[model samples]
Target: MNTIAHSTPVAIASARTPSFSPWRCYWLEAKHELLRLLRTPSFVLPTLLFPPLFYVLFGVVLAGGRSGGDMGRYLLATYGVFGIMGAALFGFGVSVAVERERGFLTLKRALPMPPGAYLLAKMAMAMVFAAIISLILAVIAVSLAKVSLQPAQWALLFAINVLGVLPFCALGLCIGAWVSGSAAPAVVNILYLPMAFLSGLWLPLQILPAIFAKIAPVWPAYHLGQVALKVVDRDGGGSLALHLAVLGVVTVAFFVLARARLSRSQ
Candidate 1:
């Protein structure tokens, strides 16, 4: 009986030892999230289709035999940034809200999952989608739009564009945590359209009103667009360092807010 009692304690101690590694949990969650995203057409289709369609409509059709010097190249770069932004916002924001509403996030939290693992997995998934969208847009731009970019230029723009979405993904997380599922899509659209338009994703900043032009630098989309333009050699008198700094600040701020909100909810 003493031996049995002692063995029970040992077994309990062993069981209490952490059953889940944070990284493993994150990876498993990320994989599942990716699969979930793939299976959901409402999520996957928009991320894949919207950017390319936007590019085709604006970059190719609207530009319409009016080669505005480097304008075509500029449009290509902007649309790529636009696509990345869409991926980050829709993928992380709407989905996170849906998960929270559906009780999926709650279920995961009840498990041995690390607090940050779910968010990390989500951010990784956003980056993956951004990269794939960037590639698809790049291919379409080169082949159909007659956009010509050297390999190095393509690589540089792709890398920076993907990195640029990090802030948006973080911002989306905060939005997801704060907003309700029913309101998320509308909230996202309200944020998305303004950011895209104000930041010159739909059109160049020079064409925008002076007020919007002044505030553009304050937005991550503006910085991301600047980064893309720089890579594509289309940024006219834009400061790379300034844009990068603003994006960095915004990312930090959003992350803090998201962490706080998420912690409080728990």
Candidate 2:
């Protein structure tokens, strides 16, 4: 009877305790998403290759022998933003759309996982990719391109690039929830590359056109670029207030729209 009584309490305690804690689940899910990204050649290749490649070509080769102004420094910040933006958008956007269409999202939802864990996992993975891109670019800039900055400045630039991926993640979510799997890639590319160029990720915003320069602040990447440039003391005269406000508004609006679209689909 004592043994039975002890067994009964233990059984009750086991029933009360969760099979898996939320934090544990979150960690596992995030790790799973990171692994998924790492294993996929299509995802890993472009995200890993493009930023460093661009920096080596434009920020290094073309930027070579120009010992005056720090063009390499400029490209480092801008291309860092460019690289993170691509990783966040394509990683989250394509995967989210494909999962939803394949019913995997529904399956994940049916599991014991917390709601939005999948989204969080993708964001975490995007940050990981952003870190790698920033590191590679910084190394290339310092070693090959001779773009030097104080250690603190390098840290600041890296942080800016990593955090700047958030707004694009929201935009990606909005696009993913609204579009089909096939359409998501084309839509993302169309929206991404042009905005990067027009936002001065490739060339100066001033060189684009009068109209393009005037509208540059409208692009999220432009705000990110401005902040990044300021890290190395080469800002383009944008107010910090405007940059923060614009990114905050864009993030909130896009996330709300994505959630609404997802709700409707269900």
Candidate 3:
């Protein structure tokens, strides 16, 4: 009786002892994902450099006196969208396929960490890359391109670019779910490059044929481009509400498709 009484509180305390918080695990998992991406030169270099580099070439040097600030501001917004798309698509699309094949994804799923942690980490990494690209582009636009905007415009553009990552991540997830490890790169390029051009990231749609302009709205990048352009008040013509709705639909659809695909593969 004495021993039982003495041990009761200890037993109760042990029973009530908490396990490691899943949120901490989630944070660590997210940090690891970000670090892993940072360590990969192939991933880091192109994503970080391409936007600012292209902006310097096209948005500044070649664009001097083209339309005064119009071209620079346009390129600023478009290239900002382009950069985020690249980061999210490559970060999730290529990484997911490769990881899925290598069994790392499977292993992670089997671990005690929350299943959502893997996805959260990937999305966080994408956002981090987006933020980096935005900062770099803003610096170059102000210092080198002489592109000026109200602070509010800059803030709005940054917000658009950061949130713009979500739809592409979903699209990338779908692509990752569909492709093999080796084919992921080819598939992503097929989707990324042509869409960018078709959606007028490379040139104004009005400058292209009417046909190209007609097709532009079909691409998710087009909607994001419109939103980005609208921030600069250079959007050609489209209800902001419509562009946002299309993007919302695209995001939800791709995510659903990706979820189904991943669920089946497992």
Q: Over the stretch 106-176, how does candidate 2's per-residue lDDT look in tens digits?
A: 89889978997888999999999999999988888878988879999998988987888899999999989
Residue 71 C-alpha lDDT in model 2: 79
By TM-score, the better pick of 1 and 2 is 2
Better of 1 and 2 by lDDT: 2
The TM-score that candidate 2 achieves is 0.93
- Per-residue lDDT of model 1, residues 1-266, tens digit only: 35544468779898889775678888898998889888989878988899889888777777763764366688878888888887788887888888888988789878877878887777788888888888888877777678888899988888887787899998898889888888989999899988888988888888778898888876788888988898777775777788888888899998899778877876
Model 2 off-target regions past 4 Å?
A: 1-19, 67-69
Give the clashing pairs for model 1.
Answer: none
The TM-score that candidate 1 achieves is 0.87
Error of 1 at 144 (Å): 1.6
Estimate every model's Cα lDDT from 0 to 1. 0.82, 0.88, 0.91
Candidate 3 lDDT by residue in tens digits, 8-55: 887888889986898998899999999999999999999999888888
Score residue 244 of candidate 2 by CA lDDT.
84
Estimate the TM-score of every prediction: 0.87, 0.93, 0.93
* Model 3 CA lDDT for position 177: 85
